[model samples]
Target: MKIDVKVPAVGESVTEATIGSWNKKNGEFVKRNEVLLLLETDKASVEVVAENDGVLAIQVEAGQVVKIGATVGILDTEGKASAVSSEAPKTAPVTASQPTQAPVTSSPASAHLSPAVQRIVTENNLNPSQIAGTGKDGRLTKGDVLAASTAAVAPTPAAAPAKTEAKSKAAPAPAIFAASGKLSKQGEKKIVPMTTIRKKIAERLVEAQNTAAILTTFNEIDMTKVNEIRNKYKDKFKEKYGISLGMMGIFTKAAVEALKAFPAVNAYISGAGAGTEIEYHNYYNIGIAVSTEKGLMVPVIKDADQMSLAEIEMAIRDYALKARDGKIGVDDLTGGTFSITNGGVFGSLMSTPILNPPQSAILGMHKVEDRAVVINGKIEVRPMMYVALSYDHRIIDGKESVSFLVKIKEGVEDPERLLFGV
Candidate 1:
């Protein structure tokens, strides 16, 4: 029996994905539920697993674009895994008419090189054993091969003699050099192909800027009350919930209340032509922007208005971990009425955030700093954080945007209101 391995639907809107890389080579035996390849969609990297224990026959190559439900490979259930040969190699196996070659040893790194890396290694006439792999499972990546090729051609006093020896060792092949010149610093210049996720991100950003009538409103919040509340119950809260009570929960709670008061900020323009209208969502689904190694991701917290502070903290923590590990899915990122991105985590003091398309508004949180302020007719120092709200001007008017921000300030400045449902 043969099992057809097809691409799984990643999301409602995502119909295609690019093959990021294959974990197992063709003809390799894979166990049931083992990861066979990584599929890179616009929002996330999904792992495709084997359905049953069988020998793999890959039909798609790395970096190839494949549609949803397309068969990427096949699993032969009845086929037996190739057995390893135990007989020793002949001392003199080459005939008079055949060329001699050096013996290659099988190592973990060498055995799992991706198709792209294997091509680079073979084309450069380089030894896979010499290159150190930094990828998952100690697999040789294209970067490793490129780095080895660069090191091999470094100019030295014995370059001429070493060149002759290298040629004699392997079949003659053209030396691979950096595009611009001879040996330069390794990291100085090397071209890398853009990934599907990155390309999609760029396109979406540009589209948001081009399509929306974007405008920004800024306000500052005194963090004194919020900090005091957290300091008072952080330990107790963590002990109760097994998660840290972070500022995200407070901000999310505040935003949800504000969105209720100013529904325009939480609405978006829909339809087409003159018949287009503003779509107002009765429910709250807030997207939290998380920065990951691959890129920025926004994972939605469904029905955020109904979740308690402890639940909000747990959800934010889970999404952050998933985004960082590339385990977040497209569904995790879709269907949000609003978005909040904290640049403060990266030490940013102030920045105007761009709106995520279809969502009318996005909130930007900045660093907290102590500043002198007039309170009760006297100068006092307070920890202040500047917040910016960027919204689509067509859907959200200036008064509504400003009022929405003020509502957030009120809730944050008086944390008791959130607890009491004021």
Candidate 2:
């Protein structure tokens, strides 16, 4: 019996997806529920799996636009997987007179590798034997290959001086302008079609610029107390929860409190003209903007207002790992009432975050630095972080935007306020 492999519906807003790389090829035998290919939609990447053990017959090639329910391939259940050799691969016999040598054959790790992992190995020219596999049953994962590649190819500091000395002895070359090279270079004249996710991002950003009155309000928070609290309990917190305490959880909680005080910031506009009215969300589903390889994805933490600090930390960590592994689902990316994006990890001191449409506002978090500030009658240095609230001016006024930011400032500055709801 043959079963058709169709693209499953990702979400209501998504009508179609671009076919990403296929994990298995035509005539390749795959087990039931094995990932066959990846579907790239605007919201998230969905992994399409085989229905049963079968030989795959690919119909639609990758990079092709495919609609939901469209058949991309066929699976013949009657086909069987080839048997593995029970004995280890034989090596050529060596005499005592010849120096002992290691076999040049490919590592057995290739059999256990996924399609993504195989691609990384081939592109980087990495030796699998030198890399210690941390995956199940000593199998190599994509992360393992990447880490090995980085370590293997990284230049040593001692070689830098000698290379510079050799360069100094060489004749100087003529300087070329960037535009001159860009226009004249034939090898660089290449183009690739945009992924579905990238296209959607472009469309939405333009729509936002055309449709909404976006404004950003900024404020700074003294992190002395928050840092003190973390320092006082980090070990205990990690021991109890099995995850480190981080600034995001505190910021997420603070944002939740601030949103409760300002209802308009949490409301979304529906309809047009007189029929238009603000739909206030009583529950908070906070979106944490996670940067993925394809594009930026906001995976909502549902009912964030109801979650504990530890729970929020766990959820944030989970989404981050999912993003790293390219496993975030469309369902994980929807229904967010508000969003928070931290550019601090990338050393961004400050940036205005754009709003996620239908949501009234987004909070931007920046890197913390020690700065001198006057406290009461004395000037002292303290750790401070800048925060920005970018909101729709149509729904949220300047006063509400500024005040909402102040609320977050207070909650973070005084950690007790967030814990006790003062």
Candidate 3:
């Protein structure tokens, strides 16, 4: 009997999923509960696993869409795993007549490569040894392989100057660049479809813009006191909690206090004028926007208002690790009262963040730099961070928005206020 490998339900909103990539090749023998493929839903990625020990027969290829209960592959229980991996290559006997050379074996670096990346390297007929690895411990990533492939084919387009002369004059150099802003692509462009998660993100962003009365307000935070706190307690905090103190937790706690003072920022308006309701949330579920290889995912920390600074730090840290490993679930991605995104991690000095629909507001954090500012009628250089609050003007008024930000500024600048719940 054969067991069906089906796409498991990830979330209520996720009706269908696209095959992100396959871990096991078609007809390959797999053990029970081994990962077969990664299923990409609109919210998060889920791994489909084999149910029984067997040879796998894949029904769907990568980039294809399938329903929640659809069988992506079939596992044959009778088929046995071969000794292909155990077989060793025969070598000539070493003798004094000829000096022995290192035994021929599989490349150690190849073991670190993912299935998708291995496929790319094989299809391009590229040598992994010649390519420089930028990943951890000099391991080749999918990106490194793509870069190497492009570099190898760099001379191909140049060799055809006569064929490109007509279009070269009319086309600006930037015209050939892809939407990703990659410069000077050497070969023909390949059209790739967006993943399920990317498409969902795009749809929501557009929905937020079209539906909500969006406006962004800016404020600069004096980081002198916050810096002192981090410098003072970061070590002890990490020692006690096993997680370093970070800005997200500080701001999240501060934001919670601010949210309590001005509930309008946390509340969202629903329905049209007459039937519209301003839904106020007593609990704080703060969504921390994480940028992953797939797209932007906001995993919410449920009841953030009740969590301590250290707890907030650990929660966000866990979410970040989960997002990185593609282990984050849809439940983690849903139901956030408010969101906070730090563009500062990518060296962005400032950005106007958009609202995550159903949620009234989002906090944008930016890079901190030392700047000269007046303090008690004296000029001094201090670390400063620019913060932006983007909200729906329909539910939250200008005064409410500005006051909420000021509350956040006060709490972070003076951590004592957060301690006393001021």
Candidate 4:
């Protein structure tokens, strides 16, 4: 019986995907739940798994664009098991020297070589075996082959000095052109195609700009108190919890408290029979915007307001590492009521961040710098950071927005307020 293997729905609204690569080839026997191919979508690269044990017959090749529900392969269930059992004994333990006449090289260049390695050998006339392979299963990398070619053509020590002298004497002398009459040579430019994730990010950014009423309100916070607390407890915190207590924990706790006070900033606007109303959520799921090579992905920390400072720090660290490694899922990137982006990590002094759509607000945290500021009528140098809260003006008014940021500023400045629920 032939079983149709169709592309499963990856996520909501994702219609199609590009075939990144296939792990198993046609006619190969595969087991149930085995990874058959990798499919790259606008958001992520997902592995297509085999549904049952069978002989695979791929309908699509790598780099082909396929839609959701498209039949990309078929599995012949009845023939596979029998074929594997029959062929295993015949092909097993076949020795390289078993009277198999030098595996017929079509050309002096045409040994058993990969397409890329073969091309390099044919173009440069280099032997494959001489190249040191760094790839898995003793395959040669492009770098290894190129390096071997250079080593093979290098002049011997006895011939080096004479060759260098001859080349220097034969080479053309430097040409000095008149400045007024000189013709400048144009350099070649290369165009590389953008990845699917990058294209989607571009589209989403434009859509965000068009859809939301973005308004940025900036405020500077005296990090003196926060820094003092961190410096005093950082060693103990790391030793006890196995994670460093960073500013994110302090800021996240503060943000959550501020959200509680200014519920409108944390709420989402939706239309009901009575018209558009503010839907305030008691639970806080804060999205931490992390930048990755693939694109910008935001992973939410569910019920962040209820988590301890140590837990929040650990969660942020885990999510950040996963995001960079591309191990984070589509579900992790969705469903957030608010977002916090740390531009300070990249050494940003100040920036007006744009709001992530469907949500009301996004907080941008900038780098800390030491400057002079008034402290109880006395001027002192202290660590300070500028925080910008960008919100949808349609949902959050200026008073509510400013007050919301002020609450954060106050909480951060006096972190003990977070402990006391002030």
Per-residue error at 23 for model 1, in Å?
2.4
lDDT of 4 by residue, 1-422 (tens): 88998887989978998776555656778999997776667776666788888888778766678999999889888764333212212234547422221222233222334433543453454546555577656666557776776676666687778878976786543254334435336432446466566788788778678877889999999998888999999999999999988998888999999899988888887775422777889889999989875668788999998899999999999998776544576677777899999999899999988777668899999999999998899999999999999998888899999999999999999998999999
Ranking by lDDT: 1, 3, 2, 4
Candidate 3, residue 407: lDDT: 91
Q: Who is ahead in TM-score, 1 or 2?
A: 1
CA lDDT for candidate 1: 0.84
Query: What would the per-residue lDDT of candidate 2 be over residues 273-378, giving only the tens digit for each residue?
Result: 5327889989999999988656788899999989999999999999987876678898898889999999998999999888898888999999999999999989
- Best candidate, TM-score: 3
Per-residue CA lDDT of candidate 3, range 1-422, in tens? 88888889888777898887767666678887788887788888887877778987777767678998998778889876554322112223556633333322345555555544654664554667667788777777879998977876665554577547756676554667766656665855797667678899999999999989999999999988998999999899999999988889999999999999999998878778532888899899999999876779999999998898888999999999888778788899888999999999999999999999889999999999999999999999999999999999989899999999999999888999999999
TM per candidate: 0.79, 0.78, 0.82, 0.71
Task: Write down the lDDT of every candidate, Cα atoms only.
Answer: 0.84, 0.82, 0.83, 0.77
Q: Write the per-residue lDDT of candidate 1 for residues 1-422, one digit (tens) a residue.
A: 99999999988888999887666667778899998888889888888999999988878876789999999999999887653211112223547543333445677788765434654664455668767788778877668898888876666564568667876887444445454535445545457677778888899889789889899999999999889988999999999999977899999999999998899988889988532798999999999999865678899999998899899999999999787656788889989999999999998999999999889999999999999999999999999999999999888889999999999999999988888767
Q: Against the true structure, candidate 2 has what lDDT?
A: 0.82
Worst 10 residues of 4 by lDDT: 82-91
- Which candidate leads the pack in lDDT? 1
Q: For candidate 4, give the lDDT.
A: 0.77
- What CA root-mean-square deviation does each model show from the true structure? 6.8, 8.9, 8.2, 9.9
Clashes of each: 0, 0, 0, 0
Residue 197 lDDT, candidate 4, scale 0-100: 67
